[model samples]
Target: MACLACLLALAFVAAEAQQMQSNISQGSSLTPTTNSTWLSRSGLYAFGFYRQGNGYAVGIFLAGIPEETVVWTANRDDPPFSNNATLRFTGDGLALPTAEGQNYLVKPSSTPSYASMLDSGNFVLYNSSREIVWQSFDHPTDTLLPGQRLLSGNELFSAKSEADHSTGIFRLKMQNDGNLVQYPVDTPDTRPYAFYSSSTSGAGENVTLNFGADGHLYLLNRNGTNIRNITEGGLPTDEGKLYLMRIDVGGIFRLYSHDLKKNANWSVQWESSNDKCDPKGLCGLNSYCVSIDLQPDCRCLPRFEYVNQGNQTSGCERNFVADACKNRNENFTYTMEELESTTWEDVSYMNLRLSDRNDCIQGCLEDCNCEAALFDGTNCRKQRLPLRYGRRDTGTSDRALIKVGVPRKPDTDPRIVQPGNKKKGRTGILIIGLSFTAFGSILLLISVIVWWKHNVWAYKRMSAVNGDLELNEGVALRRYAYEELEEMTNNFKEELGRGASSTVYKGLILGTQKPVAVKRLEKVAAEGETEFQTEIRVIGRTHHKNLVRLLGYCLDGAKKLLVYEYMSNGSLADVLFTRERQPFWEERMGIARNIARGFLYLHEECDAQIIHCDIKPQNILLDEFMCPKISDFGLAKLLKADQTRTTTGIRGTKGYVAPEWHRKMPITVKADVYSFGIVLLEIICCRRNVDWSLPEEEAILDELAYNNYHTSR
Candidate 1:
C-alpha cells in the first residue's frame, strides 16, 4: 500500500510539472483583464500582465507569495493601459500596443516560434531549434534575484514604493569606467555623488554585477576576474535559501535573503552603506539629516521651519526676513547659533582662508548672501540660504554658524509722543489716560505677585511628591543640572570612550564622591529626543546586577546627558581585543553566563519585555570584580506580552546583526540569541567574529563553526 501511494504522488508531481512547462504558441495573447498567466515548470515563477497603478505591467512574479514580488518587467517605464492592452505572441515577435495605437514589437531573429517562463524567473523567446532569442533577464527592473547577471550598460531603477510601481529616483548600474555604482537619478549630472561604488580604480570595461546563488553579490571583469565582493560576507550554504539584491527607493542598495525551509520572510543580510544620512538630497535643501537611533530624521536650522509643514524633505523657510542687500540696513544685527560637527560640502557661497574662528564668523556676518558658515578650525566656507547636504559628521572638528535675525523692538507709538509741542485738548486727554493706566498697573502688579507665589508653592509641592516616589521599585533617580554635570566631569577632560550616539567622560559625583560615567549625546532630531526619553525611562525602571544602573540625567537644551555608575574595568572589547593579556578561560565562561542572565532578565523578567537591539562587546561593561553588565539601551525596544515580534528598521553593528534584521522578517528575541551565539564563539576563540587577518575560510567564526559541525558529523 505504501509503495502504491508513493508511486501515485510521483505521478501527480510529474503531471503538474508537465502542465506548467507547456509552451505558448504564436498568435496567443495574455492580458490583465482576462487574468491570464504562464507558470514555470517548477511552479515557482509566473509571467503575466500585472496591475501597476492605473496601467498594466508585463512582468515575472513569484507564484505563491501573498504580496507580488516582481523580478523582471518588460515595459516598466511604459506600462500599458489596464483593460485596453494585450501581450500578443506573433510570428514577427512579441508585440505590445503603445498609447498612440502603434504596435511596439520585440523582434527576435528567424521568426520567433514560442515563449516560456523558466523556473529561474527568466522569460525567454525560443526559435525552432529551441535556442534562446531574447530573455527578460537581459533587461531587469529593480530587483536582481540569484543567478541573475547585470551586464555593462544595463541599469536597474528602483520603484517609487510598494504601492506605486513607477520608476523612482535611484539607479544602480555598472559604469563604463569599470565601477558598479548606485546613485540618485535626480542629481544634475551623471557624476556619482553620495553613491556606493565597487572600486576607485578604473580596472577595465565590460564589468558585470552578479547575484550568486550562495548569497554573494560579485563584481566581475570581462575576463571573469573577480573584481570585488560588493557584499563581503559569508554565504548561506542552505539550498532552500533564496537571495536577491535590490536598490530601494531610499537610495540604498540592500541584499536580502529568505529561508524556504523555515518559512521565514526576507531579511536584510547586507547593505552598501549603514549611515542613514549618507543619501544625497535626503532632506532636500537647507535642512540637516541626523540618525536618531539608526533612523534618519530631518530638521531645519535655527530660525527656520519646514517650507511645507507636512513634508520635511521640502526643506525649510526662514521665520524672519533677512536684511536686504540693496537696502543695506546697518542697524540689523544678526544672532549666530553654533552647530557642532555639521557640514555643507558642495553648497558653499564662498571659501576663505581665515586665520581665526572670529575672522570666519565676521566674514559670514559681512556677506549679505551668507546664511551659514562652516569652519574646520582653518578655512571658512560661507553657505547661501538653501544649504544642501547638511549633515552631522562626528569624526570631524567642523562647526557651523547659522545666521538668525535678532528681534527688533516694537516701534514707539507715534501718536503717544510729540517732538516739539502738544495741543491743549490732547494734553488734558493724555493726563487722564496716564492716571487710569497707573491705577491699572498697580492692580496688575498685585495679581502677578499672587500668581508667582502660587506657582512657587505648586513647584515645591510637586518636587516633594516626586522625591518620595522612586523611579522604579528600588532605584532613585536625580535630575541633575547641566552646569552641575559639567563641574563634575571637570569640563569633560577625562575622556573614556566614544560611540555613534554619544561620548563618555569619567566624573566624580559630588557629596558622595563616587565615580560615574557621563554620556553626552550628540545633537539629534526630534526622534532622537524621544529615544533619549525611552532610554532614561527604561533604565530608570529596571534594577538588576547584570544591567547598568542609571543614576541621573540632564535634559538641557541641545545637551542630553546620562549619568551611570562607572565600570572600573572598562568595556569587554578593551579586555578582549585591545589589551595584550587574554582573559582566563573560567572568566570568559562566567562572563558569557552573566550576559545570558542579563538578556534573560530583560526579555522575560522585566516589567515589560525589552529587546536590546544592539548587543556587542563594546556595550558589555565589566566592573572591578569582573562582573559583566549590559549597557547602552539607546536602541532598546519594549514590547507587550502578547506580541511575539515587531517590525523595525535595521539596527546593531554589521557583524552582530542577525539574519532576520535584513530579511524584513518580524524581529523577535531570537535576534539577540543569534548575536549571543556569535559572541560566545568569539569569546572561546579569543578573536573577533569577522577578523580579516585570518584565512578566508576561517575569517567568519559562525561559518567556521557551521563547517566544523557538519564536517564532524
Candidate 2:
C-alpha cells in the first residue's frame, strides 16, 4: 500500500508538470522593464528584450539560470531599442514596434495564432492548427543551442566584441559542398583563404552541423549518417546544465557549458583551433602576426611603422619614401633586411633561379623595380608594394628580404680643411655658395615658367584629342601602347570571342604569367573611339567584385583595345548551351544572384548611375570559380547625378533589347531591368531566348514560361 501511494504521487507530479506548458495568446506582449519575458515551461529559456550596449535588444536568453546568457538575437545588426519598444505576439507574428519602425522578430509564412517558448531553447510561432509557421532556431545569431542545426550555406558570424552583439570580423560558413570553413569577414570563401575547415568536402548533400545535448558537435549527412565528429560526446547532461557552441570575438569557434547550480561563469569545453594567430588578416597589409606566450600580436615589417598606434591590425606603412624604385639610380643605396621564419602570400611579378644566395640578393639589388625578394636558397622572387597575408611560422624555409633605402651620410672631413684655417675658409665658402644659389634660383624660375606654358598647351591639345579620357590610379588602370598590346597578345593570334564591336584575344601580362583578355575594337575609325571613351570613363571609375576589372586600355592612333582580367570559365552562354552536363541548380542560382548584384551596384549603388545597354548571357562572363562578372561596357550609358533617363539608339542584342528602346521613348534604368528579366528567364530554363530547335509553342523562352505559368494556374 505504501509503494502504490508513492507511484500515484509521482504520476500526479508528472501530470502537473505536463500541464505547465502554456501557450502565449496573440495579444500577449513583452517590454524591457515590465512583463519582460515569455519563458519555457521549465523556465529554462525566455524570449524577450535584453540589455545590449546602451539600450535593449530583442533576443532569447536563459531565464532559469542565475547568469543570463543570450543565445539568439533578432536582426543582430540593427540598432538597439529604447524602453518604449514593445515585442508583441500579434496575428502577423512576433513584432517589435519601436519608434523607428515595426520590426518582425520572426516573419511567419502563415498567420500566427499563438507562440511558445520551448524548453529546448527554441522560440516558436504556430498557426490555428498548431503547425509551426516560424521559429528562432531557423535564424541563429552567434550561438547554437542543443537540438539546433546549421544547414549548408548558412553562416554564423562572431560578435564584434564581448559586449557588442553586432556582426564582427570573422565568419563560420557551412559551405554548399559539405565543408565547414571559417574565414575573415569580407574575404572570399575560397579554400586557400580559409583559416579553419572541417575537411569534409565530399560529404553527401544535406549535410548539417549539429551540437548534441551530450556536447557532441558534429556533421551529419543526408541519410542520418555521421560524417565527422568535431568534438567527442563526453559531458554531463544533468538538470540545470546547458551547452552552446559559438564563434567567439577572437575568431575561435568554441563550445561552452554552464551549470546553473554553481551559478558561475561559462566554461570552455572545446575550441576549433589552438593557435591564436591562425586567422588571416589578424594583421592587415604590410604587417605580420606573431605569437607571444600563445597570444596574437601584430608587428610591422622592417622599416615600416604602424598605421594606427593603438590598433596594430590596421597594418603598417613605410616610414621612408616608397618611390625609391621609381627614382632609382646606380649610386642609390638599398639594404635588404632579412626576416627569418616568415612567410607571406607570394604574389611575385618576376622570379629567377640563381646559383647562390649572394646572387639572389645581388640580383634584387640591381633590379630597380624590385621592392622585395623571397629566397628559398635556389629561387629568388621579386615583389612590389603592399604585401599581404604575412605571418611568422618557425617551420618555413623561405626567407624574406625587404628592400629599404639607406640615406646618404653627409661628407664632413676635418682633414680637408686645416683646423686653424677652417673658420677663415667658412666665410669665403658661404659667400660663394650664396652667389651660386641666387644664380641657380633665377635660372630655375625661368625654366619653370617655360615648362608650365608648354605643359598647358600640350594639356589642351591632349584633352581635345582624348576627350576626357582619364583613368584612376587607385584602380591601377594603366594605358598600354599599341606595341605593348601586340607583345602581350602574341600578335593577336589566339581569339577567344568576337562581338559586333570588338574581338577578345587571350594575352599574358609581360613579366608575370598572368592571363588577360585583350578586347580590340574593330570599328575604331567610325565610332569605336566613342565606345573606348565610354568604357574608360565608366569601367575605370567603378570597382566591384561582380564587374570585370578594367586593368588598362590602349589607344595608339586608332588601335583601340581594353585589357581585362581573363575569364577562365568563359561566358554564361557557353555554360548554358555548349556544355553536355548542365550546371548544378545551386550554381545557376548563384550566377543569377551575382548578375543581379552587379546590376544593382551599377544602377543604384554607384556614385553616378550606369545602364548596361546590353544584358545577355553572352555579356555575363564567368571567372575561374564560375562567379559571374558583367563585361563589355562598350554599349553602357552613363547618367549624371541628377539625370534619371536618357535618349539613345537601340543598342542591345536582338532578343534581349528592351521594348522602350524600339518605341523611341527615353530609356531609364528600368530598361536594364527589363533586359535582366529576359536573361533571368533564360537562366532559369537554361536555354536561349529564341531557340529554333524547340517546338513551335516553346520557341520563345519568355513567352513559353509565361504561358506555362498561366496554364499551371
Candidate 3:
C-alpha cells in the first residue's frame, strides 16, 4: 500500500510538469502601444512586441536578465511599424497586423488552439492535438540556442547594432547545395564570393545545422549523423555553462561561452574566420581597409571624402567630378596615385593592351568609366567606379592607380584677423611662439633622454658579450637592441617553431620591409653565453649558399635574440614529417645533395675548422626554392687544422648522435657525417629512424641501411 501511494505521487508530479500554460488564448491579441509581454511558465523567457527606434518588432527575450536580451526577432529586414501594430492569435494561425493595416500570419497552414513561450525561448503555436505548427527556433535572428536546428530554408541575420534591432549586413545561411555559408546581406547571389563557408560541399540535402548541448556546433545529416564538428577542439564540457553561436555585426560567426563562476561576461571560444579584411562590404565602396595594430581602419583614396562622416561603411565619394571627355579642360588633368598591394577581386574590368605603367595610367584616363587601373607587371586591369574589397597586402607586388584631378589653391584664408586688430594679433603671435618654443624644448629633452638610455643599454649588452667588442665597422653582422627586435617581431606574435634552446618568430624590418626569422633564446647562463658567442663568431663570418646566414644579434640584460634571413619553407623535419604531401624524388635527391654540400663547406672551405656536434634534420632549413641550408651552430666547436677530435659532453639529439658520443670518446667532424647519413636514410624511407610505429627490427634507419648493404653484397 505504501509503495503504491509513492508511485501515485511521482506520477502526479510528472503529469503536472509536462503540462504547459498558454500565454495567449485563441482569440487574444497584443498591441505595440501597450508595452505588453507574455511570460513563460518558468519566467525565464517572454514573447512581446518591443520598440526599436520609432518602430516595433515581435520577438523573444530573456526576461530574467537585468537588461532585455532579445534572442529572436521577427520581421528583422522589414521596415519597422508604429503604434498601430497588433499581434493577434486566431483560428487559422497567429496574425501580426502592421502599422500599414496588412496582416502577416505566423503559421497560416494549421489552426492553432493557443500560443506559448517555452523555456528554450521559442515562441510556438500549437493545434488542438498539441502539435507544433510553427516556432521561433526555425526562424532565428542572430543568435542560435542549444537543440535549435538552423535548417536549409532558414537563416541567422545579425542585428545592425546593440541598440538597433534592424537586419544587419551580415548573415549565416544553410544553402540548398549542402554547404553552410556566411555572407554580407547585400551580396547579389547565393554563391559566396568573399564570404566564409564551411567548405563542406555536396552534403546539402536533408542536412541540419545544430548547436549541441555540449557547446559544439555540428552539421548533421537527415539521420542525425554528425557530418562535421564546426567547433572541433573548443567544446565546453561543464554543465549549466551558457553557450551561444552568433553571427556578429562584423559578419564574424563566433562561438561564445559564459560561465558565471569563472567570468562576468561571455568569452569567445572560436570564430568562422580570423582575417577581418576577407569579409565583403566591410568598409563601403571607394575605401580600403588596413589593419592598424590588428584593428581594422578604413581610409579613402585621394580626392575622396567619407560619404557619411559618422559611418565608414557608407564608403567615400569624389569631392569633384571628372572632366567631360568631349570638352577636356586644362585645369581638369588626371594625376595617378599609386596604391600598393591592393586587389579588387572578381570586379569586372577591361584588360589594357598597354604594358608600361604610365601607359596603363593614360589608358584609365582615356576611359570615362575607369575609376582605377591595377598593374601587376604582366597585365593591366582597369576597374569601374564604387570599388569594393580594397585591401593592402605586404606580401605581393601589385599596385593600384587612381586618377585624381590637378591640385588647386585655396581662394582665401579660412582664419583671418580684422584690419583694426593688429595689436591683438601681435600679442597672440607672441603667445603662440612661446608655446611652440616650450613644446620644442620638451621634445628635444625627451629625444636626448631616449638616446642616452639606448647608449647605456647597448654598452651593457656589448660588455656582456666582449669587453672590447666594436660593432662600428669591418663586421658584416649588425647588433640590434632588444626593443627594436621586439618591434620587428610585433612582440613575437607569429611563432614559426620552438626548440629546447629558443623560439623562432616571423618578423619584418620596419624601414626595408625585409622579412626575418628572429630566434629568442632562453635566459643565458655561463655555458649558454659561450654558445651564443660561438654562433655569432662561426655563422656570422661564414657565408655560403648552403648555410643559413646570421643577419644580426641582440643582447640586452637577460634577453638574447638572433635574427636570420627568413626561410619560407621552414625546417626539413616540417616538410618530411609534418606536411601532408611528401616531396618528389627529384626534390629529395636535391635536398640530400644540398645537405652534403653544406657539410663540405663547413668542414673545408671555411676559415676556421668547425665541427657541428648537432646536425639533425631540425637544424636544416629550406629556402623559398626548397634549397637546404644548415643552421643552429650552438653545439659547434672550433678546432685547429691539425686537430681532428676534441673531448666534449653529449650534445646532439638522440638517434642522430654518433656512437662515439655514447662511448664517452672524443667528438670529431665524423659525428656530423653520422647524423647526415641518418637524415639521408629517413628522407629516402619517409619515416623516422627511431619511430615506435614500425616493428622493432626495422625501427632504426641506420641499422636497416647497413643490413640492406650487407644483403646486396
- Listed per candidate, the RMSD to the true structure in angstroms reads 30.8, 22.0, 26.1
Best by lDDT: 2
Best by TM-score: 2
TM-scores of all candidate predictions against the true structure: 0.51, 0.56, 0.52
Q: Write the per-residue lDDT of candidate 1 for residues 305-344, one digit (tens) a residue.
A: 8989876667998887675432443334565788898766
For model 2, how does the per-residue alpha-carbon lDDT over 1-713 read when each residue is reduced to its tens digit? 99999999999999666445657888988889987777789878888889998899888888777778888888888898888878888788778876678787778999988888899989988899999999889888888998999998899998877777888788998888889999988655666579999999978678899989989999998888998999997799987678999998888899998888888789989999888888877787898889999999888889999999987667899888755544543233566898888888765644565557776776666555567887888777777667777889999888888888766445533233211121221111011111223224234323333343233222111001112224432223566778788988899999999998789999998755699999999996657888888887788766567999887888788688999999999999999877584686567767877787687668755556788998999989999999999998888997775677899988988888878898999988777776877776666567788998878898987677566555644
Please identify model 2 stretches exceeding 4 Å from their true place: 1-22, 98-101, 327-334, 355-371, 411-713
lDDT of 3 by residue, 461-527 (tens): 1001111222321234556778788889999999999988789999998655789999988848876
- Pick by TM-score: 1 or 2, better one: 2
Candidate 1's C-alpha lDDT?
Answer: 0.72
How big is the positional error of residue 211 in model 1, measured in Å on the Cα after superposition?
Answer: 2.2
Q: What is the lDDT of residue 103 in candidate 2?
A: 84
Q: Model 1, which residues run further than 4 Å from truth?
A: 1-19, 91-94, 103-111, 186-192, 232-239, 307-312, 319-323, 327-334, 404-407, 411-713
- Model 2 TM-score (2 dp): 0.56
Residue 70: error of model 2 in Å? 2.5
TM-score (C-alpha, index-matched) for candidate 3? 0.52
